[model samples]
Target: MDIVLAPLATDITCAPSTAVGQGGALIEARSDREAITRWLIEYRHSPATFRHYRKEAERFVLWLEFRGLSLDALRRHHLDEFEQFLTNPLPSSHWTGPTRPRHHPRWRPFRSGLAPASRRQSLVILQGLCGWLKEAGWVTHNPFALMRDRRRRLDNAAPPVIERYFEREWWCAMWKLLDPPVEDAPQRSRFLIARRRFLFGFAYLMAPRIAEISRARMNDFRLEEGQWWWHVVGKGNKVARLPVPDDMMTLLREWRAELGLSDMPPPHDDSPVLRALDRRRGVTDNQLYRVFKDGFSMLSDALIARNWSQDHPLIEQLRRATPHWLRHTSLTHQAQSGIELRYLAMNARHARLETTARYLHAENDEWQRQQARHRLSRIE
Candidate 1:
């Protein structure tokens, strides 16, 4: 059987079949693909969550098609095999390709093999899908429930240390590159320089996720009781009003002025904070991601031009840095500056102190110093 690999959960509004599955199903979805589409609709309000769940579900469905099986036909042993497959998807030609539009003929299910964390996340999502399907009577039982070590395999209780952030020295260097003197900056590129300055300044100070930055509007920044605050709709559709510091407000003012807006945007102004080259329309999340990616690449080139080794820690970090690193850098720097854990959690919008605590590296610094005491004495 030659299975042509293609995306499966692309259409959220895909009509469920009138026919029902075995075991008195509640949902009208007869096929695995339709059932997965129904499940994906549950996350429609959360775009990020919808995209994530769809990717995992689509991959699983493609894998099932390759195995000549259906979702309800999944077994514990099959899941174990799928888990292994995620690490090294076989016949890479069919399973992997560079990112492309879903409708593109060359589009594949994966960019490459999943790492351990990514594999765990994929399994967790599929586990939830099976649980939901069981409740909807699409399946007789959740195959995930059959696994003896399900909890141990899926739980991510131990928080990994946050390492993907710019250290102080590197951050300072980046700022210098981002904010060259007005005289030195070319007139044609002033708008771009100002935008980059404000963009990264906003990221470091507010620690907003890329989507938040993309969706931000001028009126999101407002004055209240002699202070400015940025109103945002963040992860899980939660609304938050974060303080706008003096530095960030200055950057906002500069960016707004460059766009020919008032120093402080009026309450009724819903213009996008991050504008396109036209200075009118908003940029998408992918565009925002590219801005950071290209900025880091440019910074890496600048460092190399300055005779910095490619292997230098800062250059290497820049090579791997993504937009999310700004958020990590913001929170980690705040933790290092002795901000109370409670306040740090509030700033990060994290529900648990344990999650925020991962940013704390003071103990690590002290431990390193303590270990230094055990070094062998110098020869006379």
Candidate 2:
């Protein structure tokens, strides 16, 4: 069944389904529900986000079809089922990212997102959709509201979350860690290695979002008054001033030279920073990811080629790390080094001090001892 959201303005003008916007989305919406949904079309959602939600809605529609429920027939149980479906996805529907991160040549498990985390995100979306439906009088109550939330949990006993500084020894291997340039790589393996290394490097040093990295314009970096600084448009559409490490600036300047970008550049601050090293086109998110995937595979293959396995603590830790983990590493280490939370917040581009605090808290021995004492002293 096509799940239609309420339209933008009054009279409920029907906007296109995400698939329609994509120009080739599948037929998952029921004719009736498709007719009913108008709000989602009005609500602000990116093309990618809409497309993802549409497909997920289609999945639910298909499952509803399996149970012979029409759009008008959906109740609390139906929404509950949808919630459970997201929580305990069929093995067949599981998503896999670059397992080895294309860091190495060998195939590693693509285990970046946890099932629970994904489930919660999906539920949140589902809740929003269902709440819309209920408010529109399509349903009496939202079924999704009844479902319990799941947390992002990983067992330290078996598969622990990776925690290690991308300091020197780890750093040297990490940049080239993912598979080296693949002769057969679509963007070529060599380019992938170089690009992701830059991405990994830039994010740690600057703490920009992955999207910001992909959208980073050429003119964002500047050497002014003998100091290099990066002007970044951060999440929530906020503008931020980020410190440009001298070494990172060197790499930036070099990459710009390779891009044939001018030393005396245009005045625009939003030009993409990291670009396609392919020499044919400017980079998109896909290129960034492709490079990342291939790079990780290459990196992993390098480790395995030398007979490394996940059983090794270092390899296991690397296996669990992702790009955001690098951001976390930077903030954690900065905080550990006695950087004030407020200062780190500014550098981290955090709008809220709490959000930065999560990254800033040091969980080492000294902090742990404090935690123990606090717990011991707590009033029962």
Candidate 3:
């Protein structure tokens, strides 16, 4: 197993100052390995962040080793070379497709070329690491300081290459497939899939991020003056109250009844809204994502098997869908409905109203495209 691919944060058996046998532990430079290990250990409070930082750090370290370079020996030019490598990994290297499991023989740090945003993020992490090393007196200077400024100006930028959500037809298909035994299945299995339907439906209606949805407690929802609202702690720890659409509220009531609970949640109930498999605890973000992906994959496969054209755009989108797409789909659909921008922003818990405004721009662009398509077609 590649040392870089070793379980991050949990494997402390590797020596602090050297490679761990044939596993090829990262931070290979003897002078800086111990310090890097200590820095990683500090992230125990946030395992996900630790894992992400470790992967980027490990990639840089291994790249250094591949080029017979060390952290202390790096210069501005060397950093440029590393940036280039991130954009296009060596074809002959062990890296596999991004989806390959960690244990795969061909697995490499990068599965594909990093997009502009990803490349920038990777560089930013390295810059922060260099700054930390400089502050700790391990390195004489931060090499990142020598790198050119690459700050992103989000304003006036064109939309991303891919719109990360489904169209109405595909979206409705996804929703419909959530119910009924489309094919023969056991009662117990069907019941659990019903729970998954509610999860996805709730996600679509609320437009909540995965973290917010995962952390939701039954008590977080309330019926104030007969209007349903969900209190969520969204990104940046900002607390916001979001209105629950009537249809979503009805779904919630049905789901609660299925769980043998009252249709209306109690004011102070601490029970998780999204329960674990045992129904004894809250679901983690990873688990929530799995539920969504499983549901999506099943829907996609069914659509493909239904004699839908293989090259249809809807099918293509479903094939690449992730949990985040649900949030995007909700917001995009809301925008298309001509909801007030300020209200949409509030519902999304966006810190910057500009973030919410992008949806408006995307909608306008799409409308214009349709008009152009019609105009371009000469009359029969």
Best by lDDT: 1
Off by over 4 Å in 2: 1-39, 42-62, 70-80, 91-114, 147-193, 223-226, 260-271, 277-280, 317-322, 363-367, 370-380
TM-score of 2: 0.66
What TM-score would each prediction reach against the true structure? 0.89, 0.66, 0.75
List model 1 lDDT by residue over 271-368, tens digit each: 89998888899999878888898889988999899999999999988987889999999999989889999989988988778889889999899999
Whose TM-score is greatest here? 1
User: Model 1, clash count?
Assistant: 0
Off by over 4 Å in 1: 1-3, 9-23, 146-149, 180-188, 369-380
Native-to-model Cα distance after best TM-score fit, residue 201 in candidate 2, in Å: 1.2
Candidate 3, residues 41-133, lDDT tens digits: the string is: 657655456667888877777777667776778898897788788888775345435444455665577757776767777887777787776
- Model 1 poorest 10 in a row by lDDT: 12-21
**Which is the winner by TM-score between candidate 2 and candidate 3?**
3
Per-candidate Cα lDDT values, in order, are 0.85, 0.56, 0.72
